[model samples]
Target: MMFKDWLKNKTTQLFFVLWLHISLLNLFFVNKRGIVFLWQNNSELNTLLTHFVTALTATLFYIAIIKIRLRLAEKKLTLGNNVFVFGSAVMLALIGFFLF
Candidate 1:
């Protein structure tokens, strides 16, 4: 309940969405193939592709989360909210690409 309340704030919503995005991508995307690739002399293009996939997954999660939260709140989804969420998601995804 407290956490949900905290998520209602604009900054918290952005941080929560972004952090979840980053953490989920980091947690599940790693695997044996990925490990082997990174361990080998992987090309920059391959590394870039991996980051792209991670960011895409994170962006999808962020959008789904924001939509679900809005639905649960019984609020009518608005254009402004959608735009804000999208922009935030894009920014977070880009940052995640660099960080991961």
Candidate 2:
């Protein structure tokens, strides 16, 4: 396939996987951590906002790394996309654990 087509497919797949991860995370973890957005005190709002921001930031970071990996692979650079994906996931998990 062409380079542009390959890149588009990779990006779409990455986004789908990322969405699945985020959905599962919210379903299993967010409620347990009391991150629901409800009319409550300032502290609750702050906590909810913090969790939301962290998830957003982590997703963005993952996308950036994936884009870089795609570009490098297109250029025939010696880098493994799986390695970056796994590393990013581990780092994000650690950050989430620490935050919560």
Candidate 3:
């Protein structure tokens, strides 16, 4: 398979795993310490908005990392498997933010 095809498949699989794991984490640990939700008072709209903004920012950062990874991959600068690894890490971080 071509490198682009391999990257596409790997990215899809990473996304699936990331979504599944993050969903599970949210279901099991959303209110746990150090999570943003733990500090939020859900009754207020402004507080909810703040949390939304925070989560959005985190997700954007994750996307930026993914973009950088793709650029590195395009340039053949990253080592074997490191691109997927870094992408997965970013997804996990976004998941944490989502859970919060």
| Residue 52 error, candidate 2, Å | 0.7
Task: Summarize candidate 3's per-residue lDDT along 1-100 as a digit string, tens digits.
Answer: 6977986676656555654554444433334464454333444577555545655554565667778878988998866688679978998998899799
TM-score leader: 2
Model 2, 1-100: lDDT tens per residue? 6988986676666656655564545443245667664334423656556555656675677678778878988999885789869988998999899899
After the best TM-score superposition of candidate 2, give how far the Cα of residue 77 lies from its true spot, in angstroms.
0.8
Worst 10 residues of 1 by lDDT: 35-44
18-89 in candidate 1: lDDT tens per residue? 655644444443566663223232335665466556556666676687777778678764456787799899
Q: Which candidate is the best by lDDT?
A: 2
- Looking at candidate 2, the ten consecutive residues that score lowest on lDDT are 36-45
Clashes of 1: 0
Of the two candidates 1 and 2, the one with more favorable TM-score, higher being better, is: 2
Error of 2 at 72 (Å): 0.5
Q: List the residue pairs that clash in candidate 1.
A: none
Better model by TM-score, 2 or 3? 2
The lDDT per prediction is 0.61, 0.66, 0.62
